[model samples]
Target: MNWPTAAGSDSRPDPDSEYWDERQETRPPGERRDEIIEKIGEQVRYAYDNSEFYREFYSDVDVDPRNITSFEEFEQLPILSSDDIKQEQKEHPPFGRFLCIDEEDIARIYGTSGTTGRPKVFGIGQDDWDRIGEWHAQILWSVGLRPDDRVIITSPFIQYLGSWGALAGVDHLGCTTFPFGAGMEGQTEQAVEWIADLQPDALYGTPSYALYLGETAEERGHDPAEDFDFKVMFFSGEPGASVPSTRRQIETMFDCEVVDQGSMAEMTPWMSNSGCRHLENGMHVWNDIVYTELLDPDTEESLEYGAEGVPTYTHLERTSQPMIRYWSGDITTWERHDETDCECGRTYPTLPKGIYGRADDMLVIRGKNIFPSQIEDQLHALDDYGDEFRIVVEREGALDSLQLVVEVADDAETGPDEFHDLVRQEIKSEVGVTPDVTVVKQGELDRTQFKADRVKDKRELAIDV
Candidate 1:
C-alpha cells in the first residue's frame, strides 16, 4: 500500500516541520498559561451549565463556575477522585451526572478495565473524538512518527481506550495501521512473523508487550534487532518504558527509539504529556488541550518545578464527561520546558522522569519506603536478567519481606549463583531495603501481552486470613 510523506531529503520528515502545531507548541510560556486559563474558564462554565454533576459539585463547594476566570481560581476548585467517579457511576448507572451532551449526540463509549471493580465509563461526542485523534497525532508526530510510517498497534480493541486513541492518531496521520491485536492465542507469534514479513516502521503497545514481543521473536529463532525494521516504539499502559534500564533494554532488543506516553483511563487523551524525539526522559505536557497541574497530593496545591507531586488533570476541550481537577494517583517530578531547554522547542511542561509509580504502589517495608520501579531499574540494569519479573511483598511475623522473583536471560555468561549477590546489592543500594532475590530460568515467569502487574502484595491476604 502507498503512504504519503512530506517533501524531505531523507525518509524522515523535515526537521523544520518537527511539531504538529508549531505555533501552539512553541508559544511563549506566559502566553501559553494565559491561553490555558482562558480555556479553563470556558470549560468550567460549559460543564456547570450542561452537566448536573458539575452544577452540584460546584454548588456543594459553594463556588460559582462563573466566578472562576484565572488559573488561581481554577486551582481553588474542588478535586475529583477516581473513587468519586466510581461511586457516581454506580449510583447513576452508565453515564453519571457528568454526561454533558444529550444521549442522542453520543458518538462512542469507552471505559476502564474494571479489573479492580465496576468500570468507570465515559461518553464521547463526535467532535471530542476528532479532537482526541488530533491531539494524539500531535504527540505521535512529536515522537518522530511521520505520515509515511507504517504503524502496528499491538493493543486489543477492548474496553480500555489506549489502543483506540493510537489507532485514531495513526489514521489521522495517514499512516498505514496494522491493527494486529494482542491477547489471542498465537497472537504474539503472529506479530513477530508479520513484523519479519511486512517490516512495519513503528509499534504501539504497553512497554511489557514490546519486551515480550522481542522475547517471542527470539524464541522463534528471529533476532528482533536485526529482523525487524521498526524505527520507533511508543508505549502506554505501564511505567516500564520510562524506567531507564527497561527503556534501554527495549531499545537494545528492537534497535529502535523508545517513547513513553500515557496516563489514567479517565483522561482518554492519555498522551497529554508525551515524549519528544529530542530528550531522554522528556514528556512535554500539552497544557492547552488538557490543563495539567502537578499538585501536592495532600494539600491539593500546585507544586513547583522539580517537586514530586500527583498529576492532576482538568480537561480543557472535553465537553462530554469533562474531568475537572481529576486527581490521578500517579507520582512524578516535573520541570518547566524552559528549565529543560528541550530541543523540540515546545514550551509545554515536561515530566523529566516520566511517571514514577502510583502513590499507593509504594511499599513501606521494615521502616523503609520502596517503589517497584526502583527494583525494576536495578534488576534490568544487569546483563544476566530477563525482562520478566515479579515483586511479592508479604508480612512475616513482625517484619515485612520483599521478595523478587526474576528470570535469567537465555544467553547469560554466568550462572544465577554467581550473579545473585550483585542483584541483591544493587537493589539494596537503590531502595534501602534488601530483597530476597530469587533467580529463575528464562520463560519460567508468566508473561502478559497487556499491562504487567508485577507487584503481588500477599500482606492483604494475610490480614484477611
Candidate 2:
C-alpha cells in the first residue's frame, strides 16, 4: 500500500515495512538488545541536550549522557512517570519545556486520558506527525489491512491520538475510509447504514461498540457477516478484543479476523497482534522504533523471556517528547520463538502471548489480588451469564467486598437467586473470594461506544463520612 502524504509534502518512508524486515533479520535477541541500547543512547543524549526537562532531571545524577553505556546505567536514572508529566505541565502551563522544536513545527495536539488526574497536553511536530502516520500504516499492514479495502473507524476524534492514527493509517493504505468517529448519534446510525450500503471490507473500534453495531444490524434483520462483507476487525483501547471469548464473540458476529493493536497516547503506536500466518504466538514488537523490557512489578528488576511482569518502553524514534525507560503500567509476558518459516515469513520478534492485563487494573481485595480478566474468564466459562458485566469494589464494615453484576439471557429461565449462587460458588472456587453476585436484567446496564470501564472502586466513599 502507498503511504499517504499531503500535497507537496516530502514522501515519507514506510517505516513499518522496513521495521518488520529489520527486526526479523536481526541476529539474536541479545544482539537486538545491544543495537537498541546504542540507538536509545543517541536519542537520550539528544533529548538531554535539547529538552530542558531531561536536563534538570539528570543534572543531579552525575552520569554524562554521552558516557552512559549500558541499559542498566540508563535505568539508574529516575523513572519518568505520568505524574512527572502532569507536574511539569502544571509548573510551566500549556506545553512544558520538553519541546525541543519551536511552536511552528507542531502540526497536531493531543491529551492523555486523565484517568489519574488532569490530562497532560502533548504536541506532535510535523516530522513526528509523519512518523505517527508511518507507524499507523505499519500497524494496519501488520493486521492484514489493504488499501483497496473500505474500513469504518468508530473511535472518537477529539484530542485523542487513536482515532486520528487509525484514519491516517487507512489513508496510508490507500483504503476508502469511512470516518465514522465515535458517539451513537444520528451520524453513528448513518455510518452503520453507510457501512451496510457501502459494505466496507473491514471494521475498527472498541469491542463494545463493535458488538453494539452487530446487535443493531441484527435488529434490522441484517446479519453483519452476511450483509456487511466485513473481512477483518481491528480493535484497541481494551483487553476485550484480545481475550479469547470476547474475540471469538466479535469474530463470530462479524465473521472476520479480529486482531488486537495496542498503543498509548504518549507513545506512538508500536505493538500489535497481527496476522503473521502463525497468529497464535504473542503480538510482535516494533523493536526498531520502540524497545521493550519486561520487569518484575514488585522488585522492578528486569525479567527473562517468558517471564510475566509489567512492561517498560523506550521510544527510539520520538524526538519531540522523548520517553526513555518509561514504565507503561501494563502487565505482560514475552516468549521468544525461533520459527524461521511461516505462511507470512516476516520474522520480527513476537510476544507469543498477547498482553496479560494491566498492572494498574489489578485490585487487592480482601488481601487477595485479582484482575478483571480473572473475573471475565470465569464469567465466560459459565453458559448462563452474558458477556456484559462489571466489577464493583466497595468496603462493607471495614472489609473490602467485590460485587459481580452480570447480564444474563432473559430467556434462560434462571432467577437471580440461582444465578447469584452459581456466581458466588464459581468465584469462590476460582478466585478464592466469595463475591456477591447480582443478576442484572439484560440491557439494564449502560453500553459504551468506547473502552468499557468494568472495574469501579468505591472505597473512597467509606472514608469515615
Candidate 3:
C-alpha cells in the first residue's frame, strides 16, 4: 500500500497536532494546574462509576470523587503499584475487575514481561487499541518517521506491549513494518539479511539488540547505514537509549538518530523522548490521554514542576482497565516550559531529561546507595568494553553487594584480570563502592534480543553459602 506523505516533507506534524498544544497554548501557567486537577477529578468520578475495580477500591475512602478534586486530596488516595494490580488479578483470576468491560469486549490482550513476577494481564478494547495506535503514530512522527519510511521492529510479539504498540504506530503512520521478533538464534541473522535487502528507513529495539544487529551486520560485511537508508533508530525497554555513551555508540555504529521511547504495557504509549528536533531531552507526554505527576518517593507528596521525584501517572483514556494514581516506580524531574521554546517550536511540556531510574533499582551497599544505570554509564565510558553488560546483586553477611559482568569489545586485547581491576576502580570512583568486576570474553554472556536482564539476585546463594 502506498503510504500517505505530507506535501513538503516527512518530518513530524506541526506542533498544533500535539495533544498538549491547545491546553499549553491557551491556558496560562497558573491556570493549567487547576484545569489538570479538574480533569483528574472528572476521570476519577467516571472510573469509579463505570469501573468495578475503582468502585470497590474507593468505597472505603468514603469521599465523593468530585469533592476530592484538588491535587492535595488526589494524593490522599492510596498509591497503586504493580504488586497491587498483580494481587487483584490473583484474587479475581483471568481478566481482573480492573477491567471496565466484559471479556467479550476486549479486542486485544497484552501482558507485562513478567521479569519480576507473574505478568500482569491487561485488556485493551477496540477504542483503546485505536488510541494506542494513534499515540504511537504521534511518537513516530516526533522522531522523524514518515509514511514513505519502511521500519523493522526487533521486539518480541509474545504477549508483550512494546512490539505490538510499535507495530501499530508503523501501521498508523502508513509505513511498511517488518516484524523481526527477538531472539539471536538463526532468525536474527536472517532478519539482518532481510533488512539488508529491504533497506527499511528506520529500526526499533532495545539498545543491546540494536548493537547486536550492528555487530552482526559488520560480520556479514554489510554496513547498515550504507546498505540501508536508515534515518532513525528508535530504542526502548531500557535506559541505554537515553544514556549519552550508549546513544553515541548506537548512532556511530548504525549511522542514524537514536531516539528513546518510554512506556509500560500497563500505560501503553504515553511519551517519546524524541522531539521534532533531535535533542534527546525528556519525553513529551500525551496530555490528552495521560496525566503525570512527580512525588517525593519517600513521602508520596506531590512536588511542583521541575522538582526531581518519583513519577506517578493517571490514565485519562483507559476505560477497559483503569489505573488511577498508578505509581510508575520511575524517578524523574518534570517541568512545564511555557517560555523556553524548543528548536522545533513545540509548546508541549518537555521532560528535559527522560526517566532517571526506578526507585526499586537502587541498591544500598557498604552504606552507599547506587543504581545500575550509574554502573552502566561508567562501564560504557571504558574504551574497550562492549555495550552488553549486567550488574549482579548478592547478599554478603548482612550487606548487599554488587558485581559487574561485562563483555570485552572485539578488538580489545586486555586480559580479564587487568580489565576487572580497571572496572573495579571505576566503580569505586563513580559509585563509591568497590564492586566485584568480571570481564568475560566477547559474547560470553547471553545477549538478550528484548529488554536486557542485567541484575541477577543471588541472595539465595549467599544464604546457602
Candidate 4:
C-alpha cells in the first residue's frame, strides 16, 4: 500500500476556539476506540507491507500484522525495545529496515541524545513531519497559547526532537517564536537577558532548566516573577514540571502556569502525550495520533487504571518509521478516559502523576526501592532547599549506601547542623531510607541547561572492580 497524504489543513480547528479540535479531543470512549482500532489495523498492514523490519520481526513470531485487528491481538506481538532499535541500526546503518519511505523522500533525520552509546537514528518523511507539526499545534493550543503570544524556545537544536516540534507548533499557530536554544557557554545568562528585554509570553524547555533560569535571573539582580512576561511555561524531558514540589517552585518563581508534557524521541510528536492548561497533576494521552498501553513490566499484561505500568506506545499516523508496541522505560500511574475529571473536556486517558523516572533509574538500596523523584519531592518541600541536588549510591562492602548531596538556599536561615538533621529525618520518615545528607551552599552544585542527571550510581564502580 502507498503511504497516505497528510491530513488536510482545510479542516484545521479555529485558533481562537477553546478546544484545538473539540470533536477529536472530547469524543466518547467507544467512538474513539473504534476509530483508533481501524487506524491500528491500517498501520500494522502498512508497516508489514513497507518495512522489512516489521515483516521479519512479526513473521518470526508467527504473527501476521494483517490479521491483527483488536488490542488483544496486537498485544500478542512482541514488544520493541531500544536494544532492538540499536541492533537493527547497527546491522542496517542509518535508517535501518525501519525506513518505509524512499531515501530521497526523507525530509528530516533525528536521533537519541546518545548519552550512553551510539544514538538510534530516525528518518521522517515530509508527510509525517507535517502531521507532527499539526499534532503539536493542537497540543500547544490545548495549553492556552494564543496566535499572538510570543514564545521563547530554549531547547538545543541537536538530534533532539522536543524543541524542534515545539517550534513547528509555534509556527503553525502563527505565534511569534524566538528559537533561543540552550546548552552553551553563556547562553543561560544571555537567554535571561533576552527574556528581560523582550518579555516573551511563553517559554519551552526542560523543567530543570526553567528552575535554573530563575536562579540565573536572580544572579543578574532581577526578580524572575516580576521581570518576566511569561504567562505559561511548557516543560518536557523530565518529570519536574509535574512533580508537585518542583512545579510549585517554578510557578511561584515565574508567577505562571507549568504544563508538563513529553514523548519518546523515537515517537516524533513529543507533545502528543501532554497536559492541557486546565488539566492538573497529569497529562492526557492523545490516542488518535499515538496509542499508549500501560502494561506490567514483568508479565507484559495490560494494566488497568490506577495501576503502575510501563507506557508502551504505537504510532497510528507515522508513516516513515512506525513504532508498534514500543516500550517506554518510565513508570507512571494512569486513569482510564472516563475515570479522569479534566475540565478541558478531553476524554483521553490521564497520567495522574507525570512519568516518575525511568524504571532502570530506580535505586534498590538496602532492599528498599527508591526513586530520585521521591527524594526530589522531599527536598523541594523544605523551605531552605536550593535549586540543585544529587543522589549518589555506592556499595559499602556487601551493603549499599545512599548519600544525598544537597544544596542549601542562599538566603537559608537554618544552621547546617539543624538543616542536615531535618533532611535526614524527612527522607527516613517519608521515603523509608535514612540517607547520609551532605549540605553545600547554593551555586556550589553543578547545573544543567537541559535534563538534570541528579543520580550517580557509584555502585557500578565497585562492580567493575
Candidate 5:
C-alpha cells in the first residue's frame, strides 16, 4: 500500500485562544513563555479554588499560589505523583478531593490501565468529554484521517479511556465506527470477517494486538494486505508502534501507514501527544492543550532539549481532574518546531523517539542500564524473528543475568545457534551490553490481546516511589 498524502486539517491550530498565547504550538518558545507563565499562575489559582486536595497540599508546602509567578516557582508548588493519587483515592474511597467536578456534573468515570500498579480513578464532565473528542479530532485530521473513512475499533470500550477516547475521535470527524471489542472469544475471527465484509479504511488497536490480528488473518487463509483496504493504523498503550522495525513489520503485514500515540489514564484520554504528517515516526505534543516537560530522571531538574528524561505532564484544558504537574515516569525526548515547517506544515513540538521507556522500568544489568524498548527494537529489526518476544531477567547468584528470548521464523535459513549468535552480537553492539539470546520456534511466545508482557524481571522489583 502507498503512504497517504498530506490530506486534512483542523482549525484548532489557532494563533490565540487564551490571552493571545495559547497558540504556543505554532509560536516560538521565547515568545510563548510569557503567556505560559500567565496560564501557570491562573491554573494553580484555579486548582487552589476548585480542588481541596491542591489547597491542602499547597498549604503544607508553605507557599502562596499568588506568589508563584514563574514556571520554576510553579513547579515548586509540589509534584502530584501517581502513587500519591492512588493513596489519596484509597483514603477518600472511590474519587478523591483531587477531582474538580461535583458529583452531579461528573459525566463519566474511568480507571487507569493499571499496567504498572493499582489503577488510579479519573472522571470527566460533559463539556470535558466534548473537548477531548475535539482535541483528538485535531490530531486524527492532521494525520490525514477524514470524515468519509470507515474506522473499526478493536480496543475495549467499557470504562477504559483508550477505546472510549478513540470512538470520541471518530465522532469528531464524523467517521463511521464499527466497535469490535477486544479479547472476546471470537474477536479475532470476527474482526477478520468485518475487514472482509465492511472494508474499513482505518483500525484502532494496540501495536502488538494489531500485529497479532494480521497474523491471525493470514493464518485463517486470508491475505491481510490484499483483503484489507486500510490506510491508517492508529496505535497507543504500548511502544511497538514507535519502534522502527515494529512499524515496518506491522505496515508490511497490514499494508497501512502507522501513526503512534502517547497517553495515560490519569492524564485523561485526550491523546496528549500524537504523530503528525510532518514526522511520521515522531509524535507532536498538543502544547495548546497539554504542557509536557522532560525532567532529569536522577537529578529531577528539567532536561535539555536533546536529553532523554521522564515526561512530566499538566492537563491545560481538563476540568474534571486537572493533572497539574503530574510526574509521569514514562521516558522520552522532544524537539521544538519552527515555521521552517513539517511536510504537513504544522509547527507543534515533537517527541523525537516517542515514549521509548519508563524510569520505573529501567534495568541495571552488568553495569549497563537497559530498557525493554531497546530489546524490542533489536527484535523487530531482525528479519527472521517473529513479532512476539520477551525479556527475562533472573538472578545468577550475586549478578543479574539478562536474556532476550525471541522467536525465529518458521522457514529459517540459519540454525538456532547461528541466529542466537547474531542477535547476541548485534544487541551487544547496539545497546553496549552482551545478552544471552535464546531462539525459540515460531509461536513459542504468547500472543497478547493488549499490551505485550515484554520485560519479565524476576529479580526483586525494588523501585522507589
Candidate 6:
C-alpha cells in the first residue's frame, strides 16, 4: 500500500492524536488489499523504468515488471540477499546500479560493516529521507514517545543509520535528541551519569546495552528507577525487551515500560514494526510502506500466519533505491487483527511476539531444532543464570551434544545440582533438547559493548552429512 505522504516541515500531527497515520493504519485488511494491489503495480512499473539493475534482472529472469499487478504476482519477483547486493556493489563499484536517483540528488549514505565481505552502501534522496523520517516518527510514537519528550540515543552515528535514522525521526517529531554513542570505553559510565543528571523522558539502545548501563549505574550508588525519570524505554537490535522476565527486570529497574522496535540493516534501518503505545505488547507492522511474508527458512515456502519463519520484505515507496523481496533473516510471526485485538485500536498487522531469533542462528543438534533466543528466554525465566551465557556444541561418538554454560550471577543461592536441574528442565521444555547444564562462576564470558554472541560450535565436521 502507498504510505501516506509526510506533511510539510512546518506541518505536524496533533501531539495528542491517537495515531500518526489515522487513515491507513486503521483500515480493514480487505479494504487495504485493493489499494495495495494498485500501488504494487505502480511501484513495479516505476522501478522497471528508473532502475537499470532491475530492468536487466527482470529480463534475465523472463519477468515483465509491468505484468505484476497483485501482491501474489509481485511476490513472484526474484528475492535478493545481502550477498547478492555485495556482489553487485563490487562489480559496479561504490553505489550499485540499483540506485535510481542521480548522484546529485543523493542526500545521505549509510552502510553496514560488511564483516562477511564487501560493504553494502545505500543512498537516501531528499524525498526518501523525508519519508524515512515519517516511518521512524510513527515507530517512536507507537512505542509511547511523545512530542514533548526528550530521548537519549546510545548507538554510534558514523557510517550507521541505526541511531541516526531514529534521531532524525525524533527531530521530525519535535523531541530533543540526546547524542550518547556507545561502543567506546566508559561510555556506559558516562550514560549512567547523564541519565541521572538530565532525567530524560525516554531512553533508547539495544536491550543489553541499556540494561548493562542501568545496572552499572546501580552498582555506583545511582538507582535508575529512583534517581532517573523515564516514562518509556525503547529498544532495538536485539531480543530482551520482548522476553517476559528480561522485560520485567528492566522495567522494574528503570521504573518504566520497555518497548521493542524491529528493523533490519538493508532496510531503511527503522520502522519495520512499531510497538503498541497504549499498554500493549504486540508490534504493528508498517504494511503501508513495506510488504512482507514469512517463509520456512529451509524450504523457502510461505507459512501460516502463526507459524515461525524467515521474513522477506519488499519496499514499496523507496524511490532512491528499491529493494525487492529482501530476506530479513529474522524469525518472526504475525496475525491480522480481528477488530480491537490491540488496545491501541490500530488495525496494523501485529506481531504478538516481537522476534523469535535469527533463522541462520538456529542450532540443529541431533535432529532437534533449537534457537539461542529460546535458550536465553529460559535463562531469563530463572534467576540462577547471570546476564552472560554460552552454548557449547560438540560431537561425541557420532552423536551431537549441547552444553549450556551459564554464568552464576551470585544473587541466586541455589546449589549446583539444583541449578543444573532447573536449567536442564527449562531448556528441555523450551528448546526441546535435554542437555547438560553447567553453572560457571561470574565473569566467565566476556561482555561486549554491543549484542553478545553466545553460541560456540566445537564439533568436528564429517566428510558426509
Model 1 compared with the native: what TM-score?
0.95
Best by the TM-score measure:
4
Better of 1 and 6 by lDDT: 1
For all predicted structures, in order, the TM-scores are: 0.95, 0.89, 0.88, 0.97, 0.91, 0.93
Query: Which candidate has the highest lDDT of all?
Result: 4
Q: What does candidate 1's lDDT look like per residue over 250-317, in tens digits?
A: 99999999998987678878888789788787477888877789989788888889899999998887
Candidate 2 vs candidate 5, lDDT winner:
5
Pick by lDDT: 3 or 5, better one: 5
lDDT of 5 at 180: 84
Q: Who is ahead in TM-score, 1 or 5?
A: 1
RMSD in order of candidates: 4.7, 4.0, 5.0, 1.7, 6.0, 2.4
| Residue 320, model 5: Cα distance from true site in angstroms | 1.2
Model 3 RMSD vs true structure: 5.0
Q: Write the per-residue lDDT of candidate 3 for residues 14-94, one digit (tens) a residue.
A: 544533234443455456666667677766776777777777777777467645577777777778888889988998876
lDDT, candidate 6, 1-465, per-residue tens: 344344335455787887777887788878877776776777777778888888877875544687676666776777788877888889897888888889899999889877657889988888888877777787677676778898998877677677877887888788988978888888888888888888899877778777687768878899888999999888777877777777777888888988887668677736667686664564777776677778788877777777788888777777777787788888877787762266777776777778767777778998988878778777877876777788989887788999988877767789877888888887898777788878887666777666667788776454455
- Residue lDDT tens for model 4, 203-300: 99999999889999998999999999899999889889888998999999999999999878888787878888887777889888788899998998
Query: Which parts of model 6 are misplaced by more than 4 Å?
Result: 1-8, 60-63, 339-341, 460-465
lDDT score of residue 99 within candidate 2: 78
The lDDT of each candidate is 0.85, 0.72, 0.73, 0.87, 0.77, 0.77
Q: Which stretches of candidate 1 lie over 4 Å from their true place?
A: 1-16
Residue 393 displacement (Å), model 3? 3.4
TM-score of 6: 0.93
Question: Cα deviation of 372 in candidate 3 (Å)?
Answer: 1.2
Pitting candidate 5 against candidate 6, the one with the higher TM-score is 6
Point out the higher-scoring one by TM-score: 2 or 6: 6
If candidate 5 were superposed on the true structure by all CA atoms, what would the RMSD be?
6.0
Candidate 5 lDDT over residue span 2-77, tens digit each: 1111223334433222211234345666666666566666667777888888888888665578556777777676
